[model samples]
Target: MQKNHHFSYVIGAILILAPMLAQAETKDINQTKFSKQYAGWAATIEQTESEDMLATYPASVILWAGSTFSHQYNSPRGHKFAVADASHSLRTGVAIPPGGNGKSASCWTCKTPDAPRLIKEMGEEGFSGSNFVDLGPEIKSVIYCSDCHVDGTAKLALPRPHAQNAMAKIGLPFDEQNISMQGAQTCGQCHVTYYFQPENNNKVNMPWIFGNTADAIEKYYDTRRFYEWIHPISKTPMLKARHPDFEQWSRSKHADMNVTCITCHMPTVTDKNGNDYTDHKVSGALIHFDQVCAGCHKSKAQLTATLERNKAEVDAKSRQVQNLLVKAHYEAKAAWDGGATWPMMNEGIMGIRHAQWRWDFATASHGMYAHNPKEGLALLNKAIEQVSAARDVFKQVSSQVGAAKPVYPDISTKAKAQAAIGYDEPAAVKAKQAFIKEEIDKHWHPVATTGY
Candidate 1:
């Protein structure tokens, strides 16, 4: 036992010292040597762009890098859902089956390295890759250096296994030339427009049915007669929008002008003495406007003013749309109360769903206005117009029956609104508390008191 204890201590000491020794040696190495090694690997990756070679990098490296990058870039502002943004954007959330028994496993694809391991362990009881819903509460940790670059080098590459498989099935080799396509090829798997379908048991799926644009997404929703949920008071169907960051961003001047997320969110850093390196500090462009935006805009004051103007415009337009939605909701509720049948509710439901979807698309997309003020404003303006039209239709219908003043529930507070809507708030709260306690217990040990 004593011999084993001494061996364990020696191993622990070596493990602790190993990284320090490596850093010391790395620091001693001249810039020329480091540059040569890094540049050579980068050039080779750039030349080959081999999917197989890119796949060799451990998935854990990509997961850690993605989590770290998002922590630096996306979550520093203390937004309400910053952690969810990081994890979901990284594709780390567990899949919940859409409706059945709530079994989920398929949603793990593109998110975790342990996915295959878990599936294998489950054997016949395991979930097929296509059987899960995307409704897990907390986001999973994923995305890392390995997702887009060769380990220890700065060259960009692809890590999506599903894309590669699709390409392979069609007899089109996943080639080096196609590696740089930014949307479907790179960001689409996580960042593009999406909606959750309850039919798939509230599984999240990209609405690529209409292509990746605000108009395209809106048109698809209109055509499909789809909705996320029916408003209890209004009796109108509604659609909840997720973050369409990449899609909304694509409409921006920067994208048309050829400015990529990698360009700004991942700007190059310069040392005090002038040595340049990629910042690798992901976060809002507002945090590092001088480093990221000023490089292109030339006038800092002008660009800052533009961003602020854009934010105000977006907020104002968003509220206008919200008011329209609220009005439509009340109109529909009045019709339902006045003995309107399913057919009478159809148009109102469609209007409500479309309007809410647009609102969600605009609001959920973080930094969209600042990134591309003109396009963001334009989209919101268009949505406002649509909702206004919908409201006019609702008003016309309700005018005949002399509708009552709308009872707009207070949705500003989730708990109050949920309880008012007849949901079991106490049960939900208790379940959430129990889940949190279980999670804490699973991950940590109880602390002992030191009082006399």
Candidate 2:
């Protein structure tokens, strides 16, 4: 193991005990069951995911870089590795020319508690365009007590401006007076979809100006003509979806029954002393299904099988769309290469852009397969329609160019597809390793003792 991770190791160890922490009039941010000691457990959960987190980045993401996740994407390791992971990710500011705009400090906004604190101290605009490397030492910790706590006391707080601003736009506003909203808002801080608003100092903002569903947010992005990048092959301007767990959960049946994420992910755990506190491991609810859902469900076995079935069905539908979507990108590239003009290509490219956005938005929530499979399948249906429309446009261009049939290139594997788009996997891997050693281990966030 690398040295100088003393604090990280401490939290890593406590997470093994299944941590329990924090509460108030907020029964559990109701703050009903929280004590400082217990809150450390919450901090521990915040600090580490305490499970094997490596190599779980989805295999189907062969076309990953074409979307928002960019060069590299992985299953998120909990807060303990937040700073390190960001530094190590090939997606974050690697290979940028000096003075060119790479990812800004705004990219770090959700990864560390230090971000909000620094944003408050330096002003959001002041922090926005700053270099990611320059902010490392100051941001030397992951999500912890301070991210959601007020002062040194245990009173729950809202530190994320993105969450607060987004909530207000939805008309609920920031009312600490309402503990239920407060509890969910804590998770919502980083769990919702957001885009960096270039009009507003590159500060992060949610795409909920119109509403919460996948298409509503798409309409919102449309109003602004906001997009992340052009697909290298298709030349389509595209929008990248971030995780939208909070948004999907709000529309879930669980939400209708007054269940928040904490009721499941942070279920109450009783100690040997017979006192109950929330589990701080912060794992998937399905990991310990009985702990959270056993009270309501009659047969744990049947429920587990049902949830898994839901996930499999969503995954199958998504994969089918993904195969078609990948084909559309290459097909658009063929049209461009054949000297198809914008008039002929615009419709095709737009179709690719819209189709991919729906897929990214729907599947971005890892839990959507189980938590809101209906919504997931619905958005995917739209993806199918959009990609098919894109293909129709591509076919018209192909025929007009005297190339009646566009032969699909053989990009059946990730390596082939990446090469088709001019990405260098080996170089990217090398750069990420070098960056982690020189930047992360030597100069990035040092784990905090208080995190445990």
For the record, the alpha-carbon RMSD of candidate 1 to the native fold, in angstroms, is 11.4
lDDT by residue for model 1 over 1-452, one digit each (tens)? 99999999999999999999998877623234445333422332122111221122122111112122111122222212222232322232222335534324444433432333444454413333334332232223233344455444555544544444433433433454343343223543445455445464434456655465666766777688775545565665555455566666656777676666766665666766888765443545666778778767888788788878877888777767766666666667776676666765566666666666666677667677776566666666777776677666666666766666556555444334344445553554465445435542333212100010
lDDT of 1: 0.50
Worst 10 residues of 2 by lDDT: 50-59
Assess each prediction's global lDDT (C-alpha) against the native: 0.50, 0.72
- Give the distance in Å from residue 211's predicted Cα in candidate 1 to where it truly belongs: 2.0
**TM-score, structure 2 vs. true:** 0.84
Clashes of each: 14, 16
- lDDT score, residue 61, model 1? 18
- Report each candidate's C-alpha RMSD, comma-separated, in the order given: 11.4, 8.5
